[model samples]
Target: MEFSIKDIIEAGEGYHIEFKEFLDKSFVEEVCAFANSGGGRVILGVADNGTIKGTHTDNSFRSRVQDSLRQLQLYLDIEIRVQDNLIIVEVPEGSDKPYACSRGFFIRNGANSQKLTRNEIIDFFQKEGRIRFEELRNEKAVFDNDFDERAFENFLNMAGVSRSIDRMSLLRNLDCINDEGKLTNAGVLFFAKDIDFLMNHAIVVCVLYKGTEKVHILDKKDFKENIVENIDNAILFVKRHTNVQYKIEGVQREEIPDIPDVALREAIINAVCHRDYFDRSSNVLIEVFDDRVQISNPGGLPSGLRPSEFGRKSVTRNPLIASLLHRINYIEKVGTGISRIIQAVDENKKSSVEFEYNSGFSVIFRKLDRTSEADLGESSEKTKGKNAEIILEAIRDNPTVTREELCQITGLSIQGVEWNLRKLKAEGKIKRIGPAKGGHWEVIDYSC
Candidate 1:
C-alpha cells in the first residue's frame, strides 16, 4: 500500500507504469493486467524517468477514472493519491478472475500484457477460489520408493490420526497423489524420503548453543526430511536442548519447561506450513543462543503483509501445506495461533515472544532468570533505551501479552513496541520459555 518515489522512477510501459491522458481502452488493458497478476501502480503525471510533470487534463479526470473503473465487470477500483504534483493510481491484484475494462480483457504474463481469449477468460473466472495446493494433482513426478515410511508413521502417531487409510490413499485424498498416481509438489515436500529431487529444500536445520556464538559448537544437526517429518524432528530436537521443572501435583512445587510443548509445536508447525517451497536453495533454520532460541523459515512474509503483522494476520504463502498441517493437528485453525502463542507465554509467567520478518520470518525466544530475585527489581522506566529489557520486564509477569498489550503496559506505540522487541531479539536479550501458542518468555538480561 505504500509506494515510493523509486517505484515511479522504475515505472515502464507495462506492469510498472502507464501513461494516459484519460481513462481509455489501453488503460483498461493495464487494469486487467493488475487484476490477473499481483497488483501494480499507474502514474498519471510521469513519463518514465519518474518525472512529476503534473496533470492538467480536465477537472473531471478523477470522476471519469472512477466511473471507468466502476464500469468494469470485475468491480475493480483504484486508489488515487496526489504526491508532489503527480497523481498516482494504485491497482490491487485481483483474485483468479480475469479483469476487463472497456478494451476487452487482459492478463499479465510475467511483466508483459497479454490479451485473453474467450476460453481463457472463462477459465480465469472459473479459477476464482482459494486454491488448495494439497489437492492439486501432479501427474509427472515419480514415487519410485522415494518416501520414508517410518517418518510417515511417526507423523501419524504424533498427530494421533487413525491409520485406517493407506499412505497412497491418504496421498490421493490430500491431492498430493494424482488421479493416475504420482507425487505433487506438496507430496514431494511432505512425504519424500530423500529430497535430492528438489535439492533438500524441505530440510530444517537446528543448532543448540551454550552461548550466542556458534564457534564453540555445542551441538548442531540438520533434519533432512519431508514437511511432516521435519516438523516432528525439529520439535524433538528443540526439546532435547530444553529442560522442564514441574511441581509435585498437590504440592507447592510446579512443573515447568524451558519452552511450552504446545507453543513449541505451534512454532514448528508455523515454520513448516508457511515456508516458501519455491525457493529450492533455502531451508528452515532454528538457532539456539545462551539467552534465546531463534527459529527462521526461508522466504519472508508474502505480499500484503508486513513484519509487524505476524501472528496478527493469517496470510499464509503455503496455504495447502497449512491446510494439511491443520488436518494433522500440526497447526490450529487460521488466525488462532498468534493469540494462542501469546497466551501460552503469558500463562507461564515468562518473557514475551519476538518475531522479525525480513528476508525471512525469524522468531526469538528469550530465556528467563528466576534464580536471582534481585534481577526482577529493575524499574519499567529504566528499561526504556533497553527495549528488550523493558519488554522482558513487561512480559516477565505476563508472557501472553501482544505487541499492542506490551505497548499498553509500557506506554509505547505499536511501532515503538515492535522496535524494542526487535532490538532485544537482535541483542539476544530473550529466549522462548516454551512453544509458540502456549509458550512463556525468558529474559537474558544477565548475558548483556
Candidate 2:
C-alpha cells in the first residue's frame, strides 16, 4: 500500500506502526514482535521523532533484509517496498503464532518490541491454543497402575456413562488415553493416584488472614487432589473462614454466605479450569480477608480476547479439562461462568465482584458489611456465635445428624459445620458419643 510521508508522520507510531532511522538488528526484533502480535508497518528510513531520514533503497539492501528475516526459526513472509526514498517493511500477523528469532520471543506492546519472559512465552502459547498442556502425555502416568478407579467411576456415573464399556475404550473415547495406551495430562490431573506428586502445581492454596493484611494467618490449607476435588476443597476452605447469616423465608430458614456460594464456586472453577498448567511457580490461590475474598490463577484471559468480551465470549485454554468438567456437569456452559458470578452477586444484593488481570487473573468478592447493626467496638465473636447457635439447634433436632445433613438443615457448609463442631466440642458444650458412621451428639450445655 502506498502512503504519503506527510500522512505517515501525522499518524505517529502506535501498536501497528514503528519508526526506525536505519536498518539494524533491532528491526528483526520489531518484525518478530509485529508478527507475533497484530500486523504492523516498520518505516526503516524514519526517525523516532517522526523525521524522515531516508535509507539505502538499493536492490542489494532489500535482498539482505529479506535474508535476515528468513534466518528466523519460523520463516515469515513480509512485504518490502521503497517509497519516496524510504524503506517500508510490512510485517503481517503470523499465521503460526508465537514467532521468535535468534534473539527470543517478542510481542508488540504499544510502540515498542517487548521480549517475552519464559513464563510469559508459555502463557502466550496457552492463550493462543498453541500448546495444550492437557493433551500432552505424561510418561509416568500408567493407565491401570496409577489411575484412581473410584474417581474415574464417579466421573463416569456423573457423566451418565455405563461401566459396561471396557475401561481402556472408555478412557480413549474420553480422549484421556493416547494410542500407546498411556494416560494424557488430563487423565493424570483427573484420576491419578497421586496428583500432587505428578503435577504439584495443580493444587489450590487457601489462606484466611486475621484482618485485611497478611500480617496474621488465621488458617491455611493446601489441597492437592484431582482438579474437581481441589475446587470443592477450595470452596470449603472459603466457607470455613467466612460468615453466614440466617433469614426466615416463609416456612423455611435460608442461610446466606458472606460471599454468595454461586459466585464463589464459579470463581473457583474458573481459576482451576483456565489456569496455566505450565506455570509451576504458583498454584491457584484462594485468599479470604475480613472484607474481601480473592481467587487468583496463573494466566489471565486468553490472548486476542478483549476485556469487553470477558463474560460474552467462550475460549478454552484447556479444552480437555474443560470438556471433562462439562461432562461431569461441573460446568453448565462455556463462557457463562463470569456472567453467572455477576448474576449471583447481583441477586444477593452484594458489592460488585472486581476482576483484575495482567500476567495473572484475580476475582475479588467484597464481603458485605454487617457491622452496622452492632456497636462500633463490638467483638466479632458475638456475630459468629449467632451463626453457631443455628448449628446447635440443628444438632439438638437430630443427635445422629452428619456434617452434610447439618449443612442442609442449617444452610451451613461442610467446613462451616466442622469448624463450629470443633469450637463446640472445645468449649465442652457438645460431645460426639460414637464414631463417625453412627455418631450421636450429646449437648452438655445449650447456652452460648
> Per-residue alpha-carbon lDDT of model 2 for 1-448, expressed as tens digits?
2345555454456556789897788889899888876577888888997788888889899888887788555887789988878888889888887688888878764345667654665565665554357767987776778899888888877877655556776676565777677888988988888887888888899999765557779888999888888889998899888878889988999998878998988899999999988788999999997667999999987764667877876655675677678767888877789889999998987456999988999999876545442322223787667767877887888898777666565554444556678888999999999798877999889998
Cand. 2 Cα-lDDT = 0.77
lDDT score, candidate 1, position 309: 64
Tell me model 1's lDDT, rounded to 2 decimals.
0.63
| Steric overlap count per candidate | 37, 0
* Alpha-carbon RMSD, each predicted model: 19.2, 17.1
Best by lDDT: 2
Among these predictions, the greatest TM-score belongs to: 2
- Candidate 1, residues 170-223: lDDT per residue as tens digits? 555444566567777777777777765544667789988654445566888888
> How many clashes would you count in candidate 1?
37
